[model samples]
Target: MKRTWIKKSLLVILLVGILFVLAGTVYLKMNTYAPSEAALAVAKTGKSEDQILFFEGEQGKPAIIFYQGALVEKESYSLWAQEVAKAGYPVYLVATPLNLPVLQQNAAEAIIAEHQLTAVVMGGHSLGGVMSSRFVSSHLDHAIKGVFFLASYPDEKGSLENFSGSVLSITGDRDGVLNQEAYQEAQRFLPDQTVYEVIAGGNHAGFGSYGEQKGDQSATITNEEQQTQISQLLIRWLENLE
Candidate 1:
């Protein structure tokens, strides 16, 4: 009877653990920020396969591999990626597991190998940026020509202080969700030539068209205006990289 009771207790514990895991997975899936109709319309121009959306551009130009922000749908960045592709670089918008880039930090490697891309620029929004930076830091041999961050900063472990590539960091002046303290502290991790830009009245959510993010301040500028500014900056930066 004692052995039977112990076995039953173990079974109950296993069942509870499985339930906890399922609940967490369901919560993450439900809490994800879905792309707006406008974003979806723009995304239609790109071709998607499995977890990657490809925006074609001119031949011989370095490709851009972008990672989406945590809990934000990958399609939320379609408009921005489309604009970049128009400027002459192919864009691969990668969808991470559970909308979390941290789960696949080395995703760019397979893309580089598959496309036979000799040169590449990697970037991401928010937490996606941090993970991208981590990948770039560790894979310096992958021909990464530059790194960009949208309302994001690299963690100390992903420091690029010694990187010889171009770096661009963009954020909104009214971004309430960004950790100002951490942003300032992370500056030492970026290279000396890093170009920093701030949109005057823009907020955190201006970087993507996924509606207002939780805990983010409202933006004074329209999403269109902010995205246009960001697109222009990205184009100019990519041009300079060549």
Candidate 2:
């Protein structure tokens, strides 16, 4: 009788431990993430990143290629990508090199050669926009249908003579990182073909990662709101493009 009682007690303890672990796992997953979720998730290392050829958009339209901000990983752009994709165009988010050596430019060169990119639209946030400009300027081809500048600084390092393509420049009314006056002045010199969109109360870091981009911890808005606003504006602007 003593041995029987001990065995029953141990079994109850073991079952309780298993139930606790299962409950903890479920709670974690509820707060954390799942693979199929559209939010950004990191790509594993050691796997060959795929080529930049065209990704299929809705209704057979051309795709938009998204370039990520400096130090902002590709996973961080996944939410933005899905929003754009929902607007009838699929999105390809490219990884910029650590050195930032016009890496996407090289990727574009290879991608353009292999893919039948019908109407390419390039857009990026902050430094990523600068890199996109570099890629478009060097390519010198009409394959790029248009360009979107998201809280970005124009290419001051190079002459803006070659950026004659359609431009959609977006900056928040309260953006501190990008010089609005400088961007406006630069737009004036660009052959009179640029459009600017300003979001009220939106700031500079609102353009990128929620935590990583907000070093000062002084950001005034949530990432979900910013992503929704920016993505919606981009889609509406792209739709207006001829």
Note the Cα lDDT for every prediction shown.
Answer: 0.93, 0.63
Q: Give residue 7's lDDT in candidate 1 (0 to 100).
A: 100
User: Local error of candidate 1 at 120, Å?
Assistant: 0.5
Off by over 4 Å in 1: none
In terms of TM-score, the best-performing candidate is 1
lDDT of 2 by residue, 13-65 (tens): 99999999899767644433122232434222112246332234585555677
Residue pairs whose backbone atoms clash in candidate 2: none
TM-score of every candidate relative to the true structure: 0.97, 0.70
- RMSD (Å) of each candidate, 1 decimal: 1.0, 13.7
Q: After superposing candidate 2, which stretches have Cα over 4 Å from the reference?
A: 1-38, 41-56, 99-104, 156-164, 212-217
